[model samples]
Target: MRIIRLSVGLLMLAMVGTGCISKKKYDALSKDHETLRASSASANSNLQTCQQNLAAATTRVSSLEEQIAQGKAAITALQASLEKCLSGANQGNVNISKLVDEITASNKYIQHLVNTKNKSDSLNMVLTNNLTRSLSREELSGVDVQVLKGVVYVSLADNMLYKSGSYEISDKAGATLAKIAKIIMDYKDYDVLIEGNTDNVPISKPNIRNNWDLSTLRASSVVQALQNQYGVDPKRLTAGGRGEYNPVADNNTEDGKNKNRRTQIIITPKLDQFMELIGQAPKTDGTTPQQ
Candidate 1:
């Protein structure tokens, strides 16, 4: 029995003695596993950074697109405005571009006759008010002939003719009227509006009563001169009279009153293009003009 126990103990001792493992090989395997885990962590961090950069780049691209859209819109608006302006000027010598560009939605405004307005701006700058035989007192008075707000405000005074109550465009006024007539004849293709006005003084004549009648007659007479004498286009001509209502200055002063009583010959160019810019159609002859 002792011999059998001794044999079993010997066998256990030999198994324990032979159970040897290499420390260097186990440590190498452990190091390889740690390196693999670190590499995986680094790769994940790089992927997160790449996603963040992509998001930032997308935002920048979107901003640039917005700016491009705004610029296109601005360019479109300006082009439309410029086209409309040119059209209005082409219609008449009385261009009111400044008025159109300047006047706001606020109520302060003057009357705008549609047919007359379209014709007021377009001109070739012909007959630069030089000859003594055909110019108004204002034109001869070192006047600067320039367009303002698109209206060719012809500055003239009634003192060139008439003795405060007369409608006869005096013999002295002939030289001035002749030059103007020549200009009108030269631009026969244009439209014309002869407007007459009078001071605040009450005018009650046997034939002409009130300032309205006097103003109307004066305007009519001017129209007749243009149409009959110079052979201006009657279709392009119109006469309107404003007694004391359409004053440009204070009637309390003599100079102011004179300024208000003067006549205006408005010349207009073609207006088809101008009307289109404003989303309207140019009024052809035989149709009632805008007022």
Candidate 2:
């Protein structure tokens, strides 16, 4: 009996020891699982960052490629221009270095001219917009404003400006003329040329001998009105005539004849300033080109 009791006690102690060992092993396994899960999360984060960096790099590369393509196209155009210039140069005993220098200077001068043209175009566009905006719909009914080759042209129908077959300004056209005068006064640097045009129809008025005389008188009337009544500078005003010679359309039809009989107010930048800009061409050797 005593031996049996001792055996039972040893059995119970062994079972308790086995249970403690199993609990310790379960705790260790749980810790290892958590460590593996944290490692996987860190790796995923690193992968996402790398992907973002790659995308940014791709965008930068695309921008650089486009810039390179534009540069190549510009180089090709410049090469073509240079080749054409060389072909036109004197071929016999040509000084290669001096010719290259001259070509460079010519290129610079061409660029200068292009810049000047762009500036003049901008000015003309501004002037046209300002005039169009300031004039009311009724005032602009028989008027056409346009910018052509860096010049502003305001074409007014003869019926709108003068009495039929006469050089006298009509009473109803006063308001429109006043608005135009204000615009002209605003652009103090620009000069105004009032040009009169006529159809091919012969005129036998008391004072008017022919179309030429009528056209010139019509232009003079507008010029005088602008200076005398509207307070426009006399020095900036010029009067001219184009009688049946510079027709805008065929004079055979009535509509065409009506279109041809019109007055044009040509606005241009001062010639002195423009001539000065042209005279100041750039030299290849960092000097100014001779006038």
Candidate 3:
């Protein structure tokens, strides 16, 4: 028995020395090594994916920040431009409004001027037509009716009103004078001026010294006749003499001298409205005058 045990121990030693292992243990070890290798490969793959994802995320974040900065800059530029445009538009509107106001005021003033002129012309036409129709054919023959500068001038020949070198009005002239007084009464708002024109011949009468005095006396006589005899308003009458200075013809000729001897009754409408409008004209400093 001792010899058999010795042999068995020697055999086992020899097998261990030869590196012989059991089949079940070797299989188990191989399986455990395969599982550990799979686990390690999976961990390496996950780490590589995580690093790639981090790099991609960092690049995306940089792109987003750059885009955000650009957007902010664009917004600021747009805001400034909008403000500038608004300011310019506001100023332009103010200028346009002021210009419109000035144009309106100017148009109003010009319209008033036109209205005043039209009114004066209408009055002149009315007076001329009425006076022409009221005077007789015989009376019109010795008179010239016309309107000059808003005044109705009725010029009567000296032969129709007086004789040579005389200041007395004739009895025939009384009818003509009465017609003029009727016109004066009809247009009570008008102002009447009696003007006497004389020839260049010198006068040496008791009450007259020269043509000026003769003309003056003639105008005064007509004014007195209209006021006292015809009931004309004294305030509406104004007498003046033009003598030979304002002659219609040459003083050297007999026909011209006869033409020069005349009496002019000037009737002018009142200018109250025209004067008031003129007073309300706009001032030079781009402002209206205070009422």
Number of the top candidate by TM-score? 3
**Residue 203 alpha-carbon offset, candidate 1, angstroms:** 0.7
Give candidate 3 misplaced runs (Cα > 4 Å): 1-96, 271-273, 283-291
Off by over 4 Å in 1: 1-139, 142-146, 271-291
Q: Which has the better TM-score: candidate 2, or candidate 3?
A: 3
Taking the tens digit of each residue's C-alpha lDDT, what string does model 3 give over 60-157?
99999999999999999999999999999999999888877777777777777787678878988888898889999999999899988778999999
**What is the descending TM-score order?**
3, 2, 1
For model 1, what is the C-alpha lDDT against the true structure? 0.64
RMSD to native, candidate 1: 18.8
Worst 10 residues of 1 by lDDT: 104-113
TM-score of each: 0.48, 0.63, 0.65
Residue 146, candidate 2: C-alpha displacement in angstroms: 1.2
lDDT of 1 by residue, 110-203 (tens): 2333443444443533334333335555557732244565544454467674555778776666666666777767765556777788889998
On TM-score, the stronger of 1 and 3 is 3
List runs of model 2 lying over 4 Å from the truth. 1-101, 282-286, 289-291
RMSD of each: 18.8, 24.1, 12.4
Go through the candidates in order and give the clash count of each.
Answer: 31, 0, 0
Error of 1 at 193 (Å): 0.6
